[model samples]
Target: MASRARGLNEDGGFVKWDWNKNKYIWVSKDEINKPSKPGHSKYAWKDGNKVAARRPSFKVPVKKACRQPLQVANKHGKMKTPSPKKPSRRPVHHKADFIVPGYDHGYDDGYDEVDEKENYPRNEKYNAREGKIPPPPELHSGHTTILSVMSNRLIHVNAALTFWRQGPNEYISYVIRTEDDAATVDTLPALVNCFKNKTPVSKQLSLGACFELLPTLKKLLSSKFEDYVKTSLDTLRTMLRFWWNDLIAHRNQSFSGDLQQSRSVAGIYMSAIAMTDIITKLCKRKDGIAKKAEIVGTLLAQL
Candidate 1:
């Protein structure tokens, strides 16, 4: 006798198998008398030495497509995970307060107040009261002013010389000559004395005397003397030298004093000397003697 195999079903029921028939049998202890359904038959099986008459096959029924068991997923309840936080925004800064008014777009509330003071007027009262506008102290003619006085002196000398040349018998002529000679002679001495004594002849006297005497001497000597007219030329040269020295002294003083007149005086002195030299040369010839006085007189007038 062969032993039979047995297994438990899903419901914890026992399933028995017969080796000879190769079939499974189900036995219900609670209801053993239930009839098998159609297409299934009862069967006899021997186990050990005992025989069982009626037994049902243990095959389960084929399930319909709609009746099949559904697959159920076991899902854990949803966990609450926190969302990541966003980073904070930085605060915006405004520009500083000390910015200039026109440039700044923000508030100007805290600035200091500025005080604007009006300017005072300048004091012109003293200037106005003094009438500080006298005719620019007459700008004395540099050459003319000096020459005028010299001219007057020479006139006086010439008158006296004229008088000395004419005799008393020719009373009218004498008077005229005496008057001219006195005038001309008088000027030369006065000028010489002024220079010798270091006394300054007024600019008028200095220039005038030179101008008047130069032509007169030239004229008088031209008739009798050639280029080397010693007596008259000596006198004229002496006078000119003295005048030149005086002018140089005046120029030095002016320079020390920082005066503008010194420049003019110096220029005049140079011009006069040049003119004198020209005249002397011009009248040096024998033919030139006749016109020497007239030419010299014309030159003086021009000066």
Candidate 2:
């Protein structure tokens, strides 16, 4: 060990067995900021370390960092890139006495089956009450959702009354003139309401509403607007179905015991007769209405 140390510390061409150790001490050129002749006893590797000698060129600026040499003696060492700190995991908490409303397991109330009418407009009241807006209309066929909560709330034949009261034929005229897809969809909820009943009033009004629709209906058959034509045809077909269903409802009620008390049989009979005449008149024309006479006849037969 002493010989090895001497050989490293010496700076002579020939080995000196006992040349003064102090005078012959070797200073490493790689040593940074090192003296010209540092002694072997005051060695840079005093602790058996091979630290790179710091030179004038190796003076790191105050702003810069000097990286330490790796310690090879230790089997495991800190890596340049640290092992990722273990994630600061969220601590789990036990459930307290407070109940989470929707989190309740297997609760099956009427909320699961809310039959939201597809074309029903988003009423502000309903939105507040329900806590959600209905999706916008899927089609631009001039049909829109009901404009009012009252319109939305109307059920059975009342929706059909709203349809007529709003003047559907005139609404159709405006929609056709404007040629707006949104306007076309706007008319649908009312037209749709025309078929939303099995009542006597709905049946009678369904026929008149078809007649009211005839102007817009005829224009649609020959007009260039495909979506308008489709909406008109569908509306006409649906009204006929409503008429037939109302007739059937009337038929069930015609000879019933309550007919004597309310005495609405004559009105129902007149509505059926008038529907047949108007439909037969429509059959005389070369329009699509005449083409659908078979369905009309079937509807009349059920009456």
Candidate 3:
């Protein structure tokens, strides 16, 4: 006989062959321990084996389809994960507190972002307050102020040439000949003496005299006495250089003064500019004198 498990079958019960009655018999868990014939055998166990007859197979009922859309099975689905935003690479610039009020800091639209109403008081009472009115026309007149502070130190050609050597006999004899002759004879020597003194006031006066006489000298001797003309031009050029340097030094020194004094300083600059303008015009002439006065004229013009 074949060995088997000593328990009830998985399908609930088993069938065994009865040797005494020469037939098969059904056994349940309660009768599993009953004695059997020595050579009798139990039916082989099978997954479908059962003590009772098997029931008919049944068919399942189908249901209606859903109206909703089908979803994806994966948790990630069709949507993509967005990458994290990158940090800005540009540096932020903040306005400085110590900067001047009207100074441009290259902000938006080239202006400061200030609230005018907050910083400046504005109201009918503030507008109507006493002492808020503008000054009278007499006190604030532009033309009057300008004329009042205008310099009286006018640089006339006659006044400048007063430093030239003039004697009583020469003045009396001037009616007999041309003023050009006097200029030719005395201008160079006077210039030599003026610089030889090495005084600041005298040097300034000498520069004025030289500037006044330059055109006359150039016109008179530029064609006849080339050597004398060259010497005179060279001397004038040297004087111009020294005078220009002095002018620059004086200009560079700041002067804090009243309106009249300031206007006087401005007048000096104006005179210098006018003198340089004359030299510039002379340098533009077609004559060879232009070549001689080029360097000095250019220097003064730049200043």
Candidate 4:
């Protein structure tokens, strides 16, 4: 029979197993006399309680192996097509309309001989009926014989002083006159008049008397004699100047009067006026030696 009161150290409180009586005994050092037999029940012997067995060792499940994220290729849109270029059109060439006959390429081959032969007789007939003289080959076409005459007159007047011839038995005579009358009367006429009159005492004197008196007079005049001659000549020139002015005034008035009545008269008057004015100006200088002589003598006499 198992003793109910028997204790095992592993149990919480006093408890016993019926088959293990000797293991359940409460042994003490003071009770050595009540010792159990050796090897009688070895399994039944108890000193201290055994610890509870630990739970079995186990491995935790490993995390599922992660897969790497997949890489996707990028998509591109379609490429654009290039437009085609157009070609340029060229300009058309044009041919000339009126083609002249008898023109040999670029050369003149005397092919117009027939035309000339047909026209020549008609031209001659027309010209003959008009009574026009054929021009002389040697003559100048633009200038007339009148121009030649005018040019020759200019040359003659330029040489008039030295080369002019006097009538036989003519003598040098001095005449004094006012400026207004000089233009209409010729110098030769006045000079002839002075000789005929025999008015100047100097002219009538004998050669001996002239010789005797001239030296003394010349001495008194000295260089001034030249001035005296010039003074007398100035008086003559004044006459010429007034004459020219009158002539020009007359021509201009005549031309203007004739302009409405007759163009030919007006043209003739204008031409004549132009010719005279040009000739007068050419022969007479504004500051002439004669004028200077007159001025000098007057100034000296005043001094």
Using TM-score, give the best candidate's number: 3
How many clashing pairs per prediction, in order? 38, 17, 0, 2
lDDT of 1 by residue, 1-303 (tens): 776555555344466775446799765654445564443223332222112322224432436532211111112234457999987784222333123344543346764312111121223322222333223336654768778867976666565555434421222232233334324333345444544555533322434434444545445344443543433444444454555555666557666986544444555555445556555565555564435434443433433
What does the lDDT come to for candidate 2?
A: 0.47
Candidate with better lDDT, 2 vs 4: 2
**lDDT score for candidate 3 against the true structure:** 0.47
Give the per-residue lDDT of model 4 (tens digit) for 78-171: 3456878776674222222112345333335545433433454655534433444445656766478878766755554433322223421122
TM-score of 4: 0.15
- Quickly count the clashes in candidate 4: 2
lDDT scores of the candidates, listed in order: 0.44, 0.47, 0.47, 0.35
Model 3, 1-303: lDDT tens digits are 798766545656679877557789987866776764433122311233442112221221226642221232233356778999999985332344324445555766765434321344444223323214334567756886566434322222243355333532232133123444334443355454545555554533533444444445445334455456555556555555556655565455534332332443444445545555545655776778778767656765666
